[model samples]
Target: MKFDTIIIGGGLSGMTCAAMLAKNGQKVALVTAGQSCLHFNSGSIELLGFQEGKVVERPFEGIAQLNEAHPYRKIKTEKLAVYAEEARTLLAEAGLKMKGNAEKNHFRLSPIGTTIPAWLTLEDLITLETTAELNGKKLLLANVEGFLDWPTAYLSDSLSAMGANVKTASFTTEALAFARKSPTEMRAINIAKYLDKAQNIADAAREINRLGKGFDLVLLPAVLGLAHDNVDLLRKAVETPVECVATMPPSVSGIRIENKLRGFLGQHGAVVLNSDTVNNGFFEGDKLTAITTEKLEETRLEANQYVLGTGSFLSGGLVSDYQTITEPALHLEVEAHESRTQWTSEYLFDEQPYMAFGVKTTDDFHPMKDGKAVTNLYAIGSVLSGNSGIKQATGTGVSMLTAIAVAHNILNQ
Candidate 1:
């Protein structure tokens, strides 16, 4: 079957591109072999240097500064700017909006706070992005009552800039409070306590609605509604529309982004496929046209465009354990070592996730062979290698941006 676009992975990055293309009225099919990594960590659509809707220079120069294993030591600054623009465009097209502007890095301390990295939020855009009713129209932010490390009034300031007069409500479920409670039972004191005080379904509804009075959104650390592998549950529990902003709790926001995107994409007609198994791929003069796997028994499909979003170590695109990337459809050249043993080691310095594995590409994120674009394919996300400097980096955001850039290349072509 012929398609306007064929995306191979089902991860956030891939799905982000597929969602945009499909939403814009493209015939797109997303393929994945199994589960995704989005649910594995906290969900933060972060940026290294983000503030007021712009992409600015980050203090950190390169990925090598963050970890020793970074494959390529540096990426040009101009390249990062292009990528930032691409990310913002992609999200905006798909209904997940963000700014492509420049600013400074803002990392939040935890239990739900905000960091104003260099990217910008709409000063007046925070009114109500969702359909759910907030505490009467004003946003209610709940965090540890006295948390010093947290980025306080961060998002609120941005929202206020947007004319969203919000109120802050400190609560006991702060990280410190939760830590004091028993590991298992602490949950009772936390999310459970929040629910119990409301007491009963009707009461819970009343409490959440009361809290939301004058607020159109509820900004909380990703903790409250992050259980049960679903973000929707929190909305159900709170009886109000919620935006589980973001926090540093091991990527809860990231996982939620993945879950929500997967379901949304499926409902919009994108096929998800993933697998550890390598399928035989065929190409003609460096252009991949077909692939063969056990499931399809050598079936092939044609496509007008390709967006490669195989992410970095976190996305499982490249690995030291596997020793080889197991070339997908293209027999593209990789920077593998002469001796597979030379590929990696147990040493932390040597085994840094940044280094050891990657698909070489140009600033445009298109794989290159002798300085020429490889077909109509656009490579994106962690697969490109480099550019993941610690200070001004957010993987999911990077993925979103890169996917946008790639889609821009594809659709415009």
Candidate 2:
């Protein structure tokens, strides 16, 4: 198989690039090993959470202060803003509407009773600009009968401490029966799939109405729907505003958005090959010419340009064997310390050097080898060195913006 572009990972970064390129009439092929990190996503694009132990109010303003090796420093702030807005518009057009502005960050509650600062989030997410906004409001926190992801009691206590009039409610055993999974096996995805059915949604709405009365807004688990949006259904049924709190992995919000984007990409002309891992690539004079996957024996996929969005250690793009760290598929040189002891800090949350280990890249996103750029190969996402995405809370934003930048470069070239 041959195409204009072959993307080696099917996460948000690869999919966005494939969609954009295909929409512009490029023949694109997207290959993936399996499901993406989206399944574990918090369903929000966090530009930057903290800088030097201080929370960032406006992310763009801090980009200029980041170190020279930081990835954000390579991309102009204006381009970053444009990419974020474009990403929002793309997801909205695909049916997973998002909310937030380009210049500011907002706060949303996580399942563990922590507040997460994000640049953009789902429309159904509950965000409060300040704790003062909750002072005079009555709030309802909903708990699913079988799901243990959200601790409603703890959340209620936290909210009460924040000056809100808070109450806790639960979906009854009868309503939760639709989940099908036993309590021992039940999870957010099961509940979300059950809620996706119209009949089950109606039943849930009835229960919510009875339990959520007199509340200004109802905060439910993220398990509203799996492949569909059920926020409006519950809102209409209970005649009250409703929002969802981020839950544990098998994120319903993330699944919904991924489903929408996958469908959109399929419709646009990108051929997505899931459960396929690229085992080897044919390179000629610093240019990757073709790739062969584990599943295919006789065929090789050739492309004019290639994108590596395979992600970091967690996603199998980079691997460590205690003695050394290396990129598995391409054997790209990693930027890391020679001594393993220097890779980590005493405090896990501190600036750990190993967290930033990945392939070195140029400003144009091209992977570098011994100080020279690989002409036709580009790397993006967690696979790029110099940024600890988790510490900065810029994982999704980096993926989106870098993907957009790569797509723009490819199109312009």
In model 1, what is the error at residue 57, expressed in angstroms?
6.9
Candidate 2 ranges beyond 4 A from true positions: 173-175, 178-181
Give candidate 2's error at residue 263 in angstroms: 0.7
Model 2 compared with the native: what TM-score? 0.96
In TM-score terms, candidate 1 sits at: 0.59
Which digits, one per residue and each the tens of the lDDT, describe model 1 over residues 160-246? 554556777765433335444654433322442343332332333444565676666666554433323333444676655665554
Model 1 C-alpha lDDT versus the unseen true structure: 0.52
**Model 2 Cα lDDT, one tens digit per residue, 293-369:** 98985588999999999998888999998889998877777899989998899986788888888888988889976
lDDT of 1 at 254: 47
